[model samples]
Target: MKQQTKQEILYRFPDGFWWGSATSATQIEGAANEGGKGPNIWDYWYEKEPNRFFNGVGPSVTSDFYHRYKEDIALMKEIGHNSFRLSISWSRLIPGGIGDVNPTAVQFYNNVINELLENEIEPFVTLFHFDMPLAMQELGGWESRDVVDAYARYAKICFELFGDRVKKWFTHNEPIVPVEGGYLYDFHYPNIIDFQRAVQVAYHTIIAHAKAVQVFKQMNIPDGKIGIILNLTPSYPRSSHPADVKAAHIADLFFNRSFLDPAVKGEYPQDLVDLLREYGYLPVTKEGDQKLIKENTVDILGINYYQPRRVKTKEHLPNPEAPFMPDRFFDYYAMPGRKMNPHRGWEIYEKGIYDILMNVKENYGNIECFISENGMGVEGEERFRDEDGMIHDDYRIEFIREHLKWVHKAIQEGANVKGYHVWTFMDNWSWTNAYKNRYGLVAVDLENNRKRTIKKSGYWFKTLVENNGF
Candidate 1:
């Protein structure tokens, strides 16, 4: 007689857990010029400085999601996707960002939403994903209060149009990226290194977010949830020394708490406020902005964790004549022997996901949340393709598995993490970097007339979703 074998125990998730992927309009949607769409900052920037983008590739013809939504929706269902996050192009919806709605854009979005619902996949809609309408940008962008009001109008229009079918609405995605990219670091359009402008931009983004949330509440779509997606990088110190810890705390205040506090707690961190006050970097505010923000905090939080920020005390004092910047308070400390994702140069610290969720649980009233964006981007992914036209991406499987293990641990520890969505569903155009790094479960063959092929990891992910765990 054969010996009896033990059944393997599996890590299981709660019933009805969300399993899907996220994408942005500007990154995925091609046909940038068609459908009566107006130029956003990206289109304008790419036209002016073609070389600024990777390999001179612009946003005009990306993944061609515009012409192939039906096909893409079918592929989404082919995988184990129960939910998908996509953004409405403000430029496409309201060409000038503050005028009449484009009927063409309206019809396009409705069809996509209906398709997702028909396939049993929930649609998560985001209002803005760093694609500012060129007209709005011309009006001084976020520096001018008029643009904030414009954003509020745009958000309201979106709610009224799609709020009936789309239940999950997000005000902004990684609102800080614009401040750092466009203002502080000169990586985005209208690049400038003005810290004052960066502060103003950051402050206004929160206000705009709150205004959208307020509009969402007023509309009161049944089962609707409004929130913001923030890329929260846990700040870690080189050592537990007082100076190192203090430096890390300040780094957190600048990067994490700057947006997290106002969105969740309805107030800015006192230390952050005091530091800004000391430096006279406070943004211009109107009389009732505080009241508006305090009364309109988010209903849920979308935490996008990629890596941890390791900081140490500044090695040397800043030059008095130098422009103001966040690094004035702390210096980056790269830990030796740390694992890294060489393709993206991002540290692969899987436990950071658990740390972020635990922090939200302990400090942020245990509000409902989810892993909105987490994945690895590898360069030259074509080199890994096999004879069967499939890309055997085992590394992506390992990366996601490590992250999910920590997510499961967080759930066990009482963190109210509701779902986990990878960074993207298909290989799409990344801003500036274009397609230098691919972070998709499905590969797009640019040489093969933009054909779509699900990678090995996509099959693995489908099984993972079926099991709800590894």
Candidate 2:
């Protein structure tokens, strides 16, 4: 008798796996003043000082998604995208962040959502993505409780308008970024160096997210789930020495647990609370703020893993004259012999993804989650294009494959990972980077009428989606 043949096992994912990419409205939509859209922080900042951006480029020079969304949606369908994550521009929908809805903006979003659905693409919508309306910022941004309540109203409008068709909703993306960027660092708008304001802004943002989640639950939309996207940077110590380990633990408490605990476990870390209080930097909170945060937790999570944080115990005391910040607690130590992305100045540690998912699984009750953002950025991609006019981006392909391999392993070990979405779908404008580093599978030809061309990795990703595996 002939020997029986065994079918080979392939790297297949779970049923209904989400294979898509993510983009923010300000980064892709270029109609800054059209469609009845008011200015966001980017718009207002660009108007004030355009030279701060890379190559003097601003958000107004994005990929023109506002007018070319149909073609863009076609490209997404061609790439075998089953889901996509997009943010509805608050300034566009309700100009100035809180007021009557702009009918033109409503029509545009309706068209985009309807087009995606018609093409069999599921929408994972985010209500806030770091582009708060200029009017709201004028009212003290996230630092003021007025802006917080206004954000809650904006979130409610999003649910009432788009919740019926969009099943997955996220309240905020990288909520801590604005705190660090605007208040601690000088990269974003309203650049300031005040730790107390940073603390207050961070607190109010958490409260706004909780209120949004509360409204999402109260709406009782069928087949819908709500969550937030967090860039959970895993902190590692240089060595197992007691001081180093303690430093790393404190780093974790400050960076990860500050938001992770409140978002998932419905309580802030007591150590962090005490630390803030000790410094007299505790944010102002109302009587029922704790109850609001405790009662309104997310149903899912979006983890945007790009890099890891390595630190060692501080070597020397600060000057005691500079502004106070989190770095005062620990020093960032560059790991010797670690892989690095020279273009982005970030360490390319693929195992970081697995570590994040494992942490979520073991400590955070294995809540439903997905890889919301992961990709490589190439600074000078034009040099790689061939005679056929297609850019060969095998490095990005390998980068994603290696990351997904770890993601697959974590899922098999019960990490509750639901999907993998790339950092972006196309080479749109970055905040200050201004396309200095392109991370998209599809290249946007800025010099040639903003033409879109799918790179080699884009086609390879299409196959990966079709096979549901490698």
TM-score of each: 0.98, 0.98
Residue 238, model 1: Cα distance from true site in angstroms: 0.5
| lDDT, candidate 1, at 205 | 94
In model 1, the clashing pairs are none
- Model 1, span 1-470: residue lDDT tens: 12112233256777899999999999988889999999999999999999999899999989999989899989989889999999999999999988889999999999999999999999999899999999999998989899999999999999999988999989999988999999988899889899999999999999999999998898889999999999999999999999999999999998889999999999999999999999999999999999999999998999998899999999999999988999998999999999999999989999999999999999999999999999999999999999998999989989998899899999999999999999889999999999999999999988888999999889988877766776
RMSD of 1: 2.5
Error of 2 at 276 (Å): 1.1
Top candidate when judged by lDDT against the true structure: 1
Clashing pairs for model 2 are: none
lDDT of 2 by residue, 88-122 (tens): 99999999788899999989999999999999999
Prediction RMSDs, each to the true structure: 2.5, 3.1
